[model samples]
Target chain A: MALDKQFIGREYGPYRYTLGEEKMREFTLAVGGAKPGAGTPGEPPAHVSPLLYDEQAAKAGPHGGLIAFPSFAVVFAIRPFSAAIADPALNINMQMLVHGEQDLEFLDVMRPGDVMTTTGRIADLYERARMGFVIVTSESRNQHGTLVVKGTWSAIIRG
Target chain B: MPRTYQPGDTFTHVRECDRYRPIYYAGASGDYNPIHIDPEAGSAAGLNGNILQGLCTLGWVVEAIAGFVEDPGRVRRVKARFSRPVRPEDTITFQGRVTAVQDGRLTAEVSATNQRGEDVLKGAVVEAFIG
Candidate 1:
């Protein structure tokens, strides 16, 4: 089914997510981040390692707590948008969908316990000879109403 | 802790894709697409097997940039094109180069290749704000 271009400006939600330390750690480990001073990847060393993986750095990190990794916002931002596109009104085919491109802009830090609200919009819709494209842009804001991050997720649905 | 980035300096980050990477990321990121979690589902989709999420691969590159700048928030902007599928057991390497520094922002061009030497992230760019 061809994606409806009329849905381009449709918005999804402002779902809330409270950041968690354990989630940050799990994401760090799953991505194969090389913990400082550990040959096989483990705990973070004080003087080195990315702030997202280091407890000490987290203490001194941006927002003064456990900071989520650059890509960690995905955990908080993708679900609502998924629901938006799956609306029977849109009639999107799920079986042949594949991610094609992604873009992210981090404007503020997201620390553990911070409440983030994520909202999404269908930014654009188009078609190639054998495929349909849907671009969704999401914005995440902290409890204080400060924009924390923005992401553009583009999926190419094979025809 | 702030780290200075200079133009022309290069760094490399290599990671082995855990056999269960797809499942792990699927749970963490809430992308439960069968193409990334079930091998049989992948075959039906014409892939070699359960393929890892492209964003998961991009995560490594973001981590590398965060490591370079010493803070994840310092990474201002990032974008990537999913050129190829990454299957289980792929050894992905991120090769980053400081292409330019302008107005307190450092830009890096990244090339991520798999065990087979294919450029999985053929066109990727990362911009970090240092000022």
Candidate 2:
């Protein structure tokens, strides 16, 4: 069965998230290939930037403080897209769903204590080659109302 | 002195999907989908085994550019299509080539390939600010 077109413009979230310095470090290290274990996110890899994990170093660097890894935006920004797929109305089969594509634009650096609020809407729903595609667009703004991130998330439902 | 970058410049990064990486990523990213953490669940989902989160692969793409610009904060954009699943024990190598440098921003086209030589991401592009 095809996805219902009526939910095409369905919207999700003004989800709010507060960036934490340690969480930011953990994410940066994990993606940087740190072997995370009990009580630690693992030692920072050599290639990992201090701006993302070393508070003191970051405070002394150009940004003047710790900054989230660029893609850390996905942590909170994914809320709306996840909600859409799990929406009862969408009736998407969890087993058949797979992330298909992603686009993220960062307009400003995110620092600890920055509050981000994100909102998103289903942008399109269509079937191609017997597969269903769900596209969603999201925008996240900081407490100061600066647009910090914009995302285009896509999911494919195997047919 | 600041570094200079121009079109045709290239850089590479490699990542391995260690057995527990998906679980750790789930803990950090709040994506606890069973298919990513449970081999049985993945098999039931037709994946044969648990797979790494595509977002994590996307993060590697950001790392490639951030390393190129020498700053993570300078990364302005990253986009890609997930062409294949990255399973545990798989090593994906990311190779990026600068395609444009204009108005203080540089764009690079990136490709992510597994050890088997299969492309995991298609149409990958990253942009960063240098000014």
Candidate 3:
């Protein structure tokens, strides 16, 4: 089904996501990053340093700040895309989908253990021949509603 | 503790993305999309050739930031948008600047641009510094 341009700018929910350090490490490892000081595929290239642990403590503690993973915002922005694809009127099949493109803007840093709420919207929709493209942009904020990240994702649908 | 930094501080490296370095990212990340590995599939899909996963570029950017801050775990946030595709044999350079330093946090605007000068991904990263 063709995407509706009218949905552009339509906002979705303020979904919440919690940041975790182990998950971030797992994700980095999963993506082939070298571990700190370990010369292995997907591990960080060098030791992360003990100073980071102190910083992490400060950020994760009360009255401290938050530290967010690089691509953590991807989890939040998927909401609007799911809603758009799940719409009965759109009739999109989950199996044939492809992630065409993605864009993210970090306005502020989030610490591990920080509570974040994400609000999303359909930013753009268009079609080329047999393919339809839908773009969803989401903004993530802390509990105080302070903006942390703005993410824009594009999915290409082909029939 | 106080930390000192200069504006022109930069580090650069080049690695070959070849057969041995195979696109192992697909299975590890569940992003087993054909365009990253199957050259024929990529060509059939209208791509100039087999393309590197966008996340790989992100991983490189993360590595650059980790180097700059000297601590991978201190990276609090990374925000980027994929602007173009990085095909096999495409050498990418990650360039960044220390745009801001305030209240012990260093903010840098970084990007991955290809040999063609086209931006493959661009974003800002914020890291907490402990000195």
- Ranked by lDDT, the better of candidates 1 and 2 is 2
lDDT of 3 by residue, A1-159 (tens): 477777778777878777665544444544333333334334343333222233555455432643434554554545665676666656666445556665555555555676888777778888998888878777778877788777667777767
Per-residue lDDT of candidate 2, residues A73-149 (tens digit) = 99999999999999999999988899999999999999999999999999999899999999999999999999999
Question: Interface RMSD (Å), each candidate?
Answer: 3.4, 0.6, 5.3
Instruction: Record all residue pairs in model 2 with backbone atoms less than 3 Å apart, i.e. clashing.
Output: none
lDDT of 3 at B62: 66
**CA RMSD, predictions in order:** 3.7, 0.8, 6.0
**Top DockQ prediction, candidate number:** 2
Better-scoring candidate (DockQ), 1 or 3: 1
Of candidate 2 chain B, the 10-residue stretch with the lowest lDDT total is: B24-33
Q: How many backbone clashes does candidate 3 have?
A: 20
Please list the residue runs of candidate 1 whose C-alpha ends up more than 4 Å from where it truly belongs after superposition. Answer: A33-50, A60-63, B1-4
Choose the strongest candidate by lDDT.
2
For model 3, how does the per-residue alpha-carbon lDDT over B43-127 read when each residue is reduced to its tens digit? 7777756777675666667657766766554555565666677776677787777777778777777767778878777553435
Q: Per-residue lDDT for A8-123 in model 1, tens only?
A: 89888879899888777667666653332323335543423456656775777564666777788888877556866687887777778888898989887777788999999988
TM-score of chain A of each: 0.83, 0.98, 0.72
Tens digit of lDDT per residue, candidate 1, span B1-131? Answer: 54666899897878777777788777667788999999999988888678998889988888778777766778888899998999888999899999998899999999999988998887799999885
Q: lDDT winner between 2 and 3, please give it.
A: 2
